[model samples]
Target: MSHEYYRRGKNWFTAIGLLFCVMGGIVLIQQLLIWGIDFVEDFLFNAEFTNEKVSVAMLCFGIFMIALGFRKHEEKR
Candidate 1:
């Protein structure tokens, strides 16, 4: 039972975490744009538009994934 195998697996988790974080960040920016546009139209033209709560959820999940990626997985001797 070599520790190297566990270390390799840990690296994979870090990569996946980073990927999730980046994707979530992109989605968050898109949501902000949509919300900003909606707000402007509603203010200037009296139209109703709202930002979806899912964006915030995605952001939170992404941050959580990023934190997980940095966690160390050391095999107990």
Candidate 2:
């Protein structure tokens, strides 16, 4: 396939949206790691703490924004 997705756009939204997507993905993954650690702690030490709802919501929102940004590119082609 062509490299259209990587091509730069004339506006700022595409870059910002991509950044948001990347950051959100990182946050989500970090939360996953934290959840895993908490799980281990709960199993071994009886500690209890796990909450990723906010991160999950932000990740989904970021993905939506990324898709919205891509609409600009699609319109240009």
- Tens digit of lDDT per residue, candidate 1, span 9-70? 44655566667667766765765576775653454344333333444455567677767777
Evaluate residue 30 in candidate 1 and report its C-alpha lDDT on the 0 to 100 scale.
69
TM-score, each model? 0.47, 0.47
- Model 2, residue 63: distance off in Å is 1.4
Backbone clashes per model, in order?
0, 0
Q: Supply the global lDDT for candidate 1.
A: 0.59
- Candidate 2's C-alpha lDDT? 0.59
